[model samples]
Target: MGAGLSGLACAITLEKHGISPAVFEVRERLGDRFVNAESMLSILQKPITDPVAFFAEKNGIYLKPTASIQRLLVFSQSQKAEIEGSLGFINYRGRHEHAFERQLGRQVKSAIQYRSKATYEELLMEYTHVVVATGDGEYTRKMHNFRTDLTVSLKGAMVTGDFDRYTPCAWLDYSYMEKGYGYLLPLSDTEANLVMAYPDYPENDRLDVDERWGLFYERVCRDLRQPLRITSHFHVTGYPIGICRRARIGNTFFVGNCFGALMPFLGFGQFTALLTGIYAAYDICGKGAYEELTQPLRRSYENSLVLRRAVERLDNEDLDRIVPVLGSRWGESILQGKSFNALRWLAFALRPWMTKR
Candidate 1:
């Protein structure tokens, strides 16, 4: 029921497997579900990963994979730290909400209905099968009846402005949340991102971004111990974040936040969204050409549930340590090429949950 990364990936994958699937997005635009000021969609691709190559070759999107990204910084209201690394980075600009839509739309334009809405019963009557990828929302919960707890909360804040040009790499500031952290990802010399995650659910009220702009500005100045200025105020808003317990139900399977979501420990929700989209395509393809497709989705859903719980525990227990470790030699010692713990693998396995295949 979404046309985001997962939904797009599923559309492409289904076409590859010779099956056409329709996509429905709630937002007026494709990528309106979330927002980012200055961030990097870090894709650790080296030349030939299908997804990587696809973006690069098709869009003239060239990325340097050799640790061009360095400098990991973490911050709390009172504490902050920085480290160095060679992690790669990708700078994607423009209305990304519509970027993927343009690509996928080209392949299956007939299959997608944008600016559209459909109730569950109405949807069931229109299509032979229904796959819900509507992200983490109320309808998803009622449809699946999965045991979910929206208690643990997270707030993501992003800012874009000029920094002192002291960094040639990415800097993550994870000193907040006692168990959370903030990021200072460099989109370029002129722009930097201030994204932070806190354990408390973000206040539903709109953030007076201008009023709080000074807080971030002061922090950056204090951290660098240099003068700072805000020439412009771009945009600001806060949304509620929670983790789900079940991913699939009967013929209606929940992918993306509908199934489960990764904690905001490291700002990997976008990565998770992308991953869930890919898996959704696979699961749908696994279903017989014209047969029911819920079994495989159920299996995948269970796996995601377990991983989500584990991540919640990690977020609840030791996220603070994770940032410190990432900035410390200890973390560098364990990070390997595309080989993180089983939890990461689980995220990769569940990317499709956000897509409609």
Candidate 2:
């Protein structure tokens, strides 16, 4: 039960089938507590093919699709590479609900009970089917014991400044220690997103998030040969940047970063969250309106586990090589080809379970 993109999507899907899904969100707003803009790649890959459009159409809302498509610059521990693809970009929800959050909110506004949190006992007593979308590990202890955990640690900082020079350049620098990388994604001409992760790095273990971010920000500026003009700063908003221990449990389903967030190396979890939610919707509908739908939830959860493993492998291997070569002439050449696009699409289609919607 959450109000984030995943939970909203799940609720909307159920309502679409006339099931009248009830949502319990811990927060008051449709989006989570975080302030940074998330990256969307696949589900919104194309304007017409995007789920935002689908939800808007079904719910009678006007959602204007904004395309900030660009190639991903992967920074591996060892080298750099460029991944070419049609990346889908959307703002979650802010005002008029023009982004991902607004579209999903419009679908399930009446169903969601904002500021109402559900405990284990309270949840089991209420809905006949409970879908757990909260990003809290403590809540799932008794009912679900998921062994899936992440090794990497995630830390981030949001800065509002002129990133105009790096707008489309979106650099992914991996000059950090082994299994660590720095990211620079441009949200707009005035906004830039910076995130860094370390799988085994423990520099922040001894210090609080602010202190660690202070040190990290200093380092990033030094490397970039620039000054830190942070008009606004939000750093290391959360801790222990690892995947969730479990995804699905009994009649409850999980989606989004709650299941397991991919490492920053992939930078596709935002897209994955929406895709997984859609897939969960499909699974629920396929089983028909009955408690028997729990079976498909289990299968989807198992499938997520397998996909997470593959992602771990990719993070540990390809990323170290890919990050260094981003934004280069060679990277541009690779992205300009149609063969790479075909291969990427085929690869995702080949693994239906892992495909990002």
Candidate 3:
């Protein structure tokens, strides 16, 4: 019911399959959602195979990558390691959406209705199919009765700097942020994003998020010997993370964050979102099952829960040991979508709940 990437993607896919779908958006401008929303660019780990190229070729849709990330400079409080390999890509958020959305707009402009508040009941009353891709919000839970296992507040800001955009930086210092990590991802040598993400706690309400982010960022700068200049306004928000239990409820199917597509540990959703959106169109055409389409990804994320939970329990010494391991062949295998027994390290994480499509 919204004109985010997923919604527009679904619109394009549906039209491609000869089903005319009307996408309704709350924003007046095509990319206003991105311009006014979160500022952090997402870092997605590439699959062993090219899922996007495969699907795009099959479905007649275009998935353009704005930036490619080749390596990552990972750090702890006292240690730093440069992981060399294909880390993944970054699809910028915030103002960067202007270009991306406009690119998608040309393909599906005829199907979108700007500044319209379309509801589930309203859409279902008029159309045979309804796919919700409104992203992570309370509406998904309220409408579909989906569950939220946990949520984390993320604070991000753009800074002026001359740094390597190819090698994004990550900090896993537990003392600074026990539940989550901090990152510095550069769009170019003159611009970058500084992000601090941690589990939402009771103390967050008492202290400001920017101040909290500053506290963590200060330690990152000091420990890493970086003199970054903050240049843009701070943006703060949270997504309902963790594994979702269901993707479809009767005629209404949830895609994107509405379907709990975000990975709780690292918050990568765009890759999942685009694939799910196309699957949603496929489901509407009776070509596939939405739940079945999303199950493999859910399983992969569930498997990753084992590593995510262990990172929470790690201290500086542990992070020091882990950063080097991520660059090793074993860690690279797992990151490349191969099977790895992360559980063998005496680590226990949340079990995968039975998910419905």
Judged by whole-model lDDT over C-alpha atoms, candidate 3 comes out at: 0.67
User: Which digits, one per residue and each the tens of the lDDT, describe model 1 over residues 1-357?
Assistant: 777555665566667677878778766755553433322333222122243444456433222221244554554343344555544343332254324434444555345676876876788778765666675546665754544433333333334456533343222332233333344555446554454344433541234433443454556666766564433233322333444444444455455555444333333444344445556666667744211332443343445444444444453225445556555665553442344443345556654642322
By TM-score, the better pick of 1 and 3 is 3
Worst 10 residues of 3 by lDDT: 34-43
User: lDDT tens digits, residues 1-357, model 2?
Assistant: 776666776776766666777778777766554555555444222223344454456543334444455556443434545555554454533333455676668767456787895675688787776766675434554445543344455566556655542223332333343334566656666666576655544643444545545665776565445774665444342332234444555666666665543323343454445544555665666644322433443333344444444444454445545545444767554444433542234334546645443
Tens digit of per-residue lDDT, candidate 3, span 1-357: 877777877889888888888788777866663222221222233332444455467767665554566777777767767666655655456455434456577788465787887777889898877888877655677764666666776677777767776767888875654566788777766677788877765544456666667787787567547777877655545557754567777787788778766766677676677677888888998899988998877775665555566556567787788787777776666555433344322223344221210
List runs of model 1 lying over 4 Å from the truth: 33-68, 75-82, 86-111, 144-147, 151-180, 201-213, 225-246, 287-325, 337-357
Alpha-carbon RMSD, each predicted model: 7.8, 6.5, 4.3
* TM accuracy, model 2: 0.66
For residue 193, model 3's alpha carbon misses the true position, in angstroms, by: 1.2
Q: Is candidate 2 or candidate 3 better by lDDT?
A: 3
Residue 73's lDDT in candidate 1: 59
